[model samples]
Target: MSGAQRETTEYAVPAGVLGLKGPVEKPAPGTLPLRGDLAHIALAGSHLAAHYVIPHVRTVGTEGAGLRLAPRADGEIFATLPAGSRFELLDVAGEWVWGCPGPQGPTGWCRASDLASAES
Candidate 1:
């Protein structure tokens, strides 16, 4: 998506609760399987996502995988998923898959090659 479109698609965390002023704090970037436009269905009511999804569960490969902040090799690695770890798969782009280790997560990008179907 274009930069402008991306900006427009982002969902802001809601401000205030019980008459407060500041925005409702969101969890750390990789700690919730939520982007401005999409979130895990389980987060409904707690977050606003343009669309909510039910993730497809996958398993980390024997070599394991690093969850990166961005969908590039050079992206920062925030979490290291051990082999056989369960991954909640959300979106995929090229060789990268965007997802979390679970509903409560350190969500980020992982190489598609690093994951296998649950049965694998």
Candidate 2:
């Protein structure tokens, strides 16, 4: 091995455990959290899990900010966020960003331009 260190995590369930809702996660760039059905999963060469993301919350910038099921204008609109509304930003793809209304609230994609950093 080179001077760089590689950390490997083990995922083994205890004996007699059953009825797991999701699969165990492999190493990821960030931490994985498990809640209901939402997950920050990537499958290039590993698996991942999901959970409530109350820490990475962001603000809805300007008026007419919309939270949609997909990251497109034609995506279904679930809610119209007011200026300064806070939501947990989950992922990003091009001009779109995935997020939820709150830690345990509904999740969807929103236009990245409509979102502002919470500290901004």
Which candidate leads in lDDT? Answer: 1
Clash count (model 1, backbone only):
1
- Per-residue lDDT of 2-59 in model 2, one digit per residue for the tens? 5765443222233334344466644322223222444432121233334322246677
Candidate 2 residue spans exceeding 4 A from truth: 1-55, 117-120
- For model 2 the local lDDT of residue 101 reads 55
Model 2 residue pairs with clashes: 33-50, 33-51, 39-50
TM-scores, one per candidate: 0.77, 0.53
After superposition, which runs of candidate 1 have C-alpha atoms over 4 Å from their true positions?
1-23, 117-120
The residue-level lDDT of candidate 2 at 65 comes to 74
Residue 88, model 2: Cα distance from true site in angstroms: 1.0
